[model samples]
Target chain A: MLETINLTKQFNGQVAVSGLHLNIEAGEIYCLLGANGAGKTTTINMLLNVFPPSSGDALIGGLSVTENPLETKKRLTYIPENLALYPNLTGAENLRFFCGLSGLQLGVTEIEGHLKKAGLQPEAMHKRVETYSKGMRQKVGVALAIARSSDVLLLDEPTSGLDPAASNDFARLLELMKDRGAAILMATHDLFRAKETGTRIGIMNRGKLMDELVASDISHSDLEQVYLNHMKS
Target chain B: MMSHLFYFEWLQLRKTWSFRLTALIVPVIIGYSLLLGHQRVQDQHAQIQELLESEQTFYDDLAERRRAIELGESEVEHWFQNPGNPLVLAQFGGSGRYVFLSPKPLAALAAGQSDLFPYYGKIALTNRSAMRDNALENPVMQVAGPFDFAFVLVWLIPLFVITIGYDVLSREKEGGTLALLQSQPVSIQKILLMKVLFRFLVISGIVLLSVLVFGFLLGIPIGSQAVIPVLLAIIAYIAFWFALCVLVNWFSDSSAINAITLVGLWVLFVLIIPSLISLFASNQHPVPSRAMWVTDQRGIQQAVNEERHTFFESWKADHPEEVMDGDTPDFYLIWMQRLLTNEVIQDRVDEATERFNSPREQQVGVISKLRPLSPSMLMHHWMQQVAGTDAQRLQSLDGEMREFQKDWKGYFIPRFRQLKYFSAEEISQIPRLDFD
Candidate 1:
């Protein structure tokens, strides 16, 4: 489970993320939809403890990210928007290195299995990440989340640069992870994918969560309408 | 976790062509430096051997002449050529021995100031100046300096270190791997440490292996008392460069910036700062010119020659016992007067030499005190000390040789004053120079 209690962030007396409270339970995919400076990335950065909040807290698996960063970090995994990996290392090697950091010692066969489950082609498993496309690099990011087996996954713009087919493949991968009872928070701008994949959604504007909706209660156009309404005001 | 980090760094370095090239080239440079130093040591040894052979021949001829005179086989034409004459024996026999400075066992490693200084002195009844006999070397070659182990360790090794370490962090940050790495559970500081340590180990291993191989090939005793200090100095110098890399990496976020900053620091410490210090020391305590000293010595010699006739007659009147068969006008009086006048001139020469050398000694003293400001200077001093090629050690040896020259002259002055001819047995009993 992941939760934020009135989570807020400020830079030099100006608010970047202010008074945000949310909960993501097991098997839940909460999609945060927002404009460029809407604090979606800031929200995720707080959850990752990239920096401490001004006066709020994020909890991963019931542990405060600020108070018990290492413990909470061990239970969660993060993938930045630009998913940069060691270019000289193969996909499997990158996976092995990151997995080793999380204290998971997986063998070669198990590593390849995680890569396969993340929708990466078996042929690309042994190729260096320098030759990887943006979509291929995202597959390695998904593989890292799977290899760590973390209960909480925080992803920042995971589908921004992918083709429709690759986006759909990534949406299915998230569905598979959700089915495994992992609580996920994904920040993205694609309304269709958000409506299709998220169990619930939050629309953000200028460092505040302006609205929330259940994905099943609204159609894709309806969610887009709600998002635009928040953005306009 | 540490081992996993090291393995990752090792894998990356193994694939880096620049790193591979540096690893290959450093040893070849070291071997070439060792060869050059060995050649220098061999040249010095050959000169010493030649001097010893010439002295031996002189001794053998003198012994043969004394035997002929004892058997009454030939009549000598002139007192100057007769081995029986004390004046001839003192002037031409083994009394004019060559005082050779043999190379230290580990001298081939550093060369140091040995190329600029003389390793031999021709000691006779007159005072010998070590600096005046500077081994007839080409001035241009002296200016270019020798490519020796000290040059490699003090100047070139830092470049190799910078090449290996300058991008240890900045490259990862630039490629975006740093974010991914920081996202992991490990702290970024530990990861950087592991990366730098991995490179340090690789470079240090190569340097140590080169030193050991050269030590064996050049026959330097690796187990001697100087070995540990030399090794410690090398390790300290390597550590200093690595520490500089760490400081540069901390403030830089781009590989190009890190490289430029590190190379700048290398020039400051290795080349610029030491040169500045040397220039400052020389200006603060300037040595007098040797040319002026030579001019003063010549004037003193000319003055003594002008009074030579009166000086001999006064000495003959004072030491009437040494005058034999007054009608013959014994030539021993002339030789005694020459020896006395030469001793007075030697005193004046010693005073001028001291005045000329004081500022140089002061300059060296100032530089030695300032050496810790740059590790390169410290390593240069340490290496020279270890090899026994530094100016201080050579100066001490020269002092000992001067003392021995005095003892040699003292042993024969009384024989000349008593007008005694040396027998073959007596010639063999002359005080021989023993420098170990």
Candidate 2:
């Protein structure tokens, strides 16, 4: 379960994210659609407690991210726009190392199994990450989330630079995490992906939430028109 | 957790070219420096041994000739060569003794100020002065200093610590791994501390192992009590630099910024602060030049020469009974003026010497109190002290010889004033050099 209580963020007297309230249950994917300055990343950063909220709180499984930073961080996984692993380390080594930071001591076979679940080929998992494609790196990030069995997942434009096929594959991974009961919050600019994969879609303009819709209640064209009209307004 | 980190860090660092280069180059430099230091200590020992042998032979020949002359077997070829005269025995060429300081077990660790200050000196009845070594002729030492273990420990090894530790936290931020790392259960402070600690251990281990290995190979006493202080000082010095690196990395986000900041700190603490402290201390307590002191001594000699006659009359008036009843011997008459004039000159010269020495002592005191501001200076002084080669120890020669000179005079000055000639047996009673 993930929740925000009137979470607000400001930078130098400018509001990056205005008062926002969201309640997403387990097994739901809440995709926040916004343009470049829509405060989607700011909201996710607040939840990650990358910086403290100007007012109110971002909570993970009922624990405040700011007050219980390390404790709440233990229950979640974050995938940023470009996931950077140690370029000098093998995919498996990078996995083992980051997993160790979370107190997960996955063995060689277990690490390979998790990579496989995240749709990485067995051969590519042992190679150095400097030789990895962006898609392959994102798969490693997904594998980390699966390995942690994270209670919540926060993704900030994770699939922004991937090809259409890679983006579709990532959409499938999100679906898999959703089916496993992870409450997911993804910030994105893609309306089609939101309609196709998100359980609930919230469109934001500037710093305020413009509308919230069940993914099933909106058609693909209708979602596009709504996102455009909100942008024009 | 430590074991796992050890293996993990090894796996990561083994591929790193910087660490690999450090592993290959640092040992060679350290080992070579130790060998050079050992050779330096050896050369000092050889010179001391040679001087001692010559001194023994000089004394033996003197005693032998005195014995032959007392029995009327050998004739005195020249008045200056007469072994019976106290002046001849105390002041003639090849007659004066030399006092030397032997090397300690840990002397090989640092050359320090020994190469600039003499370790041994000539002790004569008229004047005692320290003899200088040939360090001034060494351009390499003049410019860059000798490649001794102390030089490597104090100056070069900190660069390697910076190499390994400068990027402990900044690399994560630069590589975009920091965000993910922040979301992990571990605090960044713990991770930073551990990384800095690991690198500190690595550099310290390399230095200690290399020094001991080369040290034993060169026959430097690896078992001496002196080794403990040297090793402890090395560890503390390494920790000081690594602590600086960690502090810089605490808020630095770019590897470049951290590198620049750490190197700047090294320059500030190692080079700039010490130079400024020495400059400040010197300005506060300025010593007069050596040439001025020499000129003062010459002036005292002239003044004392003029007053010698008056001083003799004053002494005669005080000790009429001790004055001889008959006409004095030519030897006693000449020796009295020389001895009395020398006594008055020595007193005046001491006053002048204090003027030269007092301000220098004050300068040393000021520097001593300010040494803690720069750890590099602190480490240098610590190495010198532990190795028994510090300026404070070498400069102690002046005071030590001052006492020894008094004892030397006590033995011969009384005999010279009484016009007493030595027999063969009395020659053995002259004071030998035994300083504590």
Candidate 3:
């Protein structure tokens, strides 16, 4: 489980994220939707302890991120939009290295298993990431997350550059992770994907949460209208 | 975690073409340097051997004459030509011994000031100036300096280190892996430290192996006391460059910036700083002109010539008991007057030489104090000292040579003053220089 209570972040005299509260339980997928500068990534960064919040706190499995960053990091995996990896290393090698960082020593076969589960083809596993597409690199990121078997996953625009087919595959991978009882917080601008994959969607505007709704309770068109209205006002 | 990081770093380095190239090139350069140094050592040995052979031939000729005279040969053309005369023997029978400073076993590793200064001196019974008779060498070669092992270790190794290490962290950050690495359950500082340590070990290992291989090839005694100081110097110099690389990488976010900064530091420490220190030391303590010393020696010789009559009269008065109503041989009187006049000139020459050397001593003192400012300078000094080619060691040898010359003159002056003729056996028993 991951939670943020009254989380706020200020840069100099300006507020970037203000008074945010969220509760994501195991087997939940929470997508943060907002325009640029709407504090969606700020919220995820705070959750990852990339930076300290101005007030309040983020907890992963009930452990404060600021007070126990190493412990919290061990329970969570982060995948950024670009998913930068060692270009000289093959996808399987990158996955193994990350897994080692997380203190997991997986055999070669097991690493291949994680890569296949993350939707990377067997033939592409041994090729250097320098030749990998953005989608393929994301799959390696997913493989790393799966190898860690973390309870919480924080992703920042993970599907921004993926083609429609790759994005669909990524959505399916996330759904599988959710079914296995992992809490995920993803920040993205893709309203359709959010509606298709996110268990719940939260709309943020001007560093504040403007609205939130369960995906089953709203149509994709209606959520888009709501997000546009918030951006205008 | 550290071991895992080291493994990954090793994997990457093994695949890096630049690293492999450096690893191969360093040994080749070392081999070339060792060969050059070995050739230099051989030249020095050959010169010393030639001088020794020439001196032995002169002694052999004198011995032949002594044997002929002992066998009741006809009288020589003059008494002074007699090999049995103590004065004639001292003058012509190899009394000008060559005091040669043999090259140390590892001297080829660092030529140091050995190329600038004479390692051999001819010490005769005359009061000639010591500064005028240095071995002739090509001035341009001395200025260009030898590309020996010490030059490679002190000047070039650091550049190789910077080439491999400057981008260790910045490359990761630029590739966007640093963020992913930071997301891991490890501190960034520790990761960078491990990365630097791995590269340090790689470079240091290569440097040590080069030293050992070249030391063996050059016939340097790798287990001797001198080897320890040279090894310590190599370790410290490599460590300094590694630390500089890490510090630059810590503050730089781009590979280009890291490279520029590290190379800038290399130029500053290796080339600029030592040159500046040398310039400042020389300016502050300029070596007195050698031309002036020569002129002073000429003037003193002229004055000695002018006082020859007075010198002979003083010698006669001091040796009244041996004079015996003006019965002393003219050869004996002339020899006594020359010895007395040489003593007076030597005192003045010694005083002037001391004054002339004061500035050089001051410069050496200043350089010793400031050597720590540049690792290159420190390493150069260390290698030179270990090779027995440093100025201090050469000066000590010069002092010992002067003492031996004194002993040589002491033994023969009394025999001349007593007007005693030397036998073949007595001439053989004359003091000879032993360098121990």
Query: Using lDDT as the measure, which candidate wins?
Result: 2
What does candidate 3's lDDT look like per residue over A1-233, in tens digits? 99999999999969999999999999999999999999998888887778999999999999999999889999888999899988888899889888998889889999999999999999999998899999999999888888898899898999998999999999999998898889999999999999999999999998999998999899989998999999999
Model 3 TM? 0.92
Instruction: Rate residue B306 of model 3 by lDDT.
Output: 99
TM-score of chain B of 2: 0.92
Candidate 3 off by > 4 Å: B49-61, B71-81, B127-140, B321-330
Per-residue CA lDDT of candidate 1, range B345-377, in tens?
777777877888889999999898888898888
Clashing residue pairs in candidate 1 (N, C-alpha, C atoms within 3 angstroms): none
lDDT of 3 by residue, B1-436 (tens): 9899898888778878869988999888888887888888888789878988887776666667887788878558887778777777666545567776788877888877776677877777774223323443666666556688888888888989998888888888898988887788877678878988999999988888987887786787776876777777788888999888888888888889888898899889888998899899999999878999999989988998898899879777787775645477776767777878888888788788789889989988988999899878888888888777888887776677778778878877777777677777766666667763
Estimated TM-score for each candidate: 0.93, 0.89, 0.92
**In terms of docking quality, how is candidate 1 classified?**
medium
Candidate 2 lDDT score relative to the true structure: 0.85
Name the candidate, 2 or 3, with the larger lDDT value. Answer: 2
Tell me the tens digit of each residue's lDDT in model 2 across A1-233.
89999989999999998899999999999999999999999998888787899998988899999999999988899999999988888999988988898889999999999999999999999899999999999999999999999989999998898999999999999999999999999999888888898999998988889999999998999999999999999
Better of 2 and 3 by DockQ: 3
Candidate 2 lDDT over B128-170, as tens digits, reads: 8788873568677676777788888888888888887888777
DockQ of each: 0.69, 0.58, 0.70
| TM-score winner, 1 or 3 | 1
